[model samples]
Target: MPTYAYRCRECTETFELNRPMSESSAPADCPEGHQDTVKLLTTVALTGSAIGPAASAPSGGCCGGGCCS
Candidate 1:
C-alpha cells in the first residue's frame, strides 16, 4: 500500500489516503460533498542514512579544521 495526498478543488480541502497501487490514482470526491477533487503525488517514507542534513554529511573533523581539535 502507498499513501497518497489529495486536494479537493471544490471545497479546497486536503486529505491523505492509504491505498493499493492499482487504485491509488483513482479520482476521489471530497467527503464534504465537493466533487472536484484531484489526487496529488504519492509519498514514501525515508529511513537509515537518508534522513536529515547531519545524517547526509560525513562524520567529519571540521570545516578546514576551523573548530576541530
Candidate 2:
C-alpha cells in the first residue's frame, strides 16, 4: 500500500491515507467530513549511500545524509 497526502479545501485540513496504487487518483475525505479534497504531492525518503540514480542528486541540507560536515 502507498500513502497518499490530501488537503481539504473546505476546512483547509491536511491528512494522509493509505491506498492501492490503482486508486491513486481517488478523492480522499477529510476528518471534518469534507468531501472537497485534493491529493498533495509527497516525497519519499531513501536511507542509504548515494548510489544509482540518486548519486548525482545534490545534498538536501546540513543535517541531510550521514555526514554533518
Candidate 3:
C-alpha cells in the first residue's frame, strides 16, 4: 500500500491516507470530517550509492586496453 497526502481546504488540515494506486485520485475526507480536500503532490527522497565490483569498474576502450599506444 502507498501513502497519499491530502489537505483539507475547509479546515486547512493536512492528512495522509494509505490506499491503493487506483484510489489515489479519489476524494478523501479529513479527520475533522471535512470533505473539501485535495490530494497533495508528494515526492520520494532516494539516497543511496551503487555497490559491488561493477560499480567500481572503469570504462574500457581501445586506449584503455593499450591498443592505441
Per-residue C-alpha lDDT of model 3 across residues 1-69, encoded as one tens digit per residue:
999999999989999999999998999999999899999999998899767655444556655685654
Cα lDDT of all candidates, in order?
0.77, 0.87, 0.88
Best of the candidates, TM-score: 3
Specify the poorest-scoring 10-residue window by lDDT in model 1: 50-59
Question: Candidate 3: where are CA atoms >4 Å away?
Answer: 48-51, 54-59, 62-69
- TM-score list, all predictions: 0.58, 0.66, 0.72
Name the regions of candidate 2 deviating beyond 4 angstroms. Answer: 49-69
Best-to-worst lDDT order = 3, 2, 1
Model 2 residue 59 CA deviation (Å) reads 29
Per-candidate Cα RMSD to the true structure, in Å, reads 7.2, 11.6, 3.2
lDDT over C-alpha atoms for residue 40 of model 1: 80
lDDT of 2 by residue, 1-69 (tens): 999999999999999999999999977889999999999998999796755663454676666776665
How far off is residue 38 in model 3, in Å?
Answer: 0.4
lDDT of 3: 0.88
Give lDDT: candidate 2, residue 6. 94
In terms of TM-score, which candidate is stronger, 1 or 3?
A: 3
Output the better candidate (1/2) by lDDT: 2
Query: Which RMSD does model 2 reach against the true structure?
Result: 11.6
- Residue 39, candidate 3: how far off, in angstroms? 0.4
